[model samples]
Target: MPEYRRSLDIYQGYNYKKDKQTPVGYLTKIKVAGTDLTVDQTCKDPTNPTTDLKCVAVLSGALWETGVTDAVYLSGQVSAPNRQTLASLIINSLTSVEVVYQFAVYDYDPVAKKYYLAFHANQTDMNGLLEKRGEDLNVSVADDASTEVQSPINYSFQIGIKPQPSAQTLHIATADQKNVVKSWGLALG
Candidate 1:
């Protein structure tokens, strides 16, 4: 089977006033506003030069706010017509496939002092029979200032496809530095 590489882009935004008093034991809730999926067919499989192979790409992921809300998930799959063909090609050659996902995060309790953002993704064969593969991306947030903020945090996941699909690394960053306070990947696994 060909190898595949998958990546993700998670955009997070919120409106919260730092000075606003938060109720005791308040929890921030991050919801999935919407999502978009894209696949780029870079090159042909080196092993088999005869058939023009295409990747069977599917995007599935979730957003989790630590100590706050339950996970909110989403999945995007390729159309039925392309599913079989792409799945066959991916199983034959070690082809690398790039899938990009765009999603938005809306913070429910923006006044919370601190919270952690956790993003996860799962990839499977077209039939959804293969072993489930996943990736996890995390970021830490703390806001001390008393200001309402709206920002986006982008997360990228590079996945290496093998007998068992595994995430190579996760990249997380935000443009709004004032509200972020701090952010980083918890671990690469």
Candidate 2:
């Protein structure tokens, strides 16, 4: 089998927000870039061997917001620094987003090292925080003797998010000055 080089573009976009905030919330949006992976095809002896092709790609980003509420204390203690104050302040949290891509191999080309991508998914139509990864391109098969065959392999994408520093802010801090404006917000509740 011959070596092959291919380029594929995958675009993904999703909304992530906190379920609810104790006192404040931030507006955020996250855009994820595309990813590329290599695929190989091999055969043993004169017969085509049973083979499997698996790939896993992970994408992550942090969402931040400014001017969140924080904890405050009253003027009464002189040494107790960790005491609960009667005042409130602004705070922020980090939200990490993760996505994965999975596909199963079904066939291959002998002349060119290209594998077929085939994966099964449920056919449902619903709109409510759905993780969508754009379709993946197929591997090309070409030889010096014949024209190249454009075989589009199929795959599926999965996405999720995890909230970091689950602290409630009482005050709205400066996003530009504090760099909180660069982060994505989880929810507005």
State which candidate has the highest lDDT.
1
Worst 10 residues of 2 by lDDT: 70-79
Per residue, candidate 1 scores C-alpha lDDT tens digits across 98-162 of 22323222122334334222222212121101112453222111222112211212122222211
> What's the CA RMSD for each of the models?
18.5, 25.8
Query: Model 1, poorest ten-residue lDDT window?
Result: 24-33
Clashes of 1: 7
Q: Can you write out model 2's per-residue Cα lDDT over 1-189, one digit (the tens) per residue?
A: 211112221211111112211111111112212211232211121112243222222111112122222111101110111111101000112131221122111223334343222111111111112122353211111112111211222222222322223332221122212211212223455
Q: Show where candidate 1 strays beyond 4 Å.
A: 1-60, 63-78, 97-107, 110-189
- How many angstroms is residue 182 displaced in model 2 relative to the true structure, after the best TM-score fit? 1.4
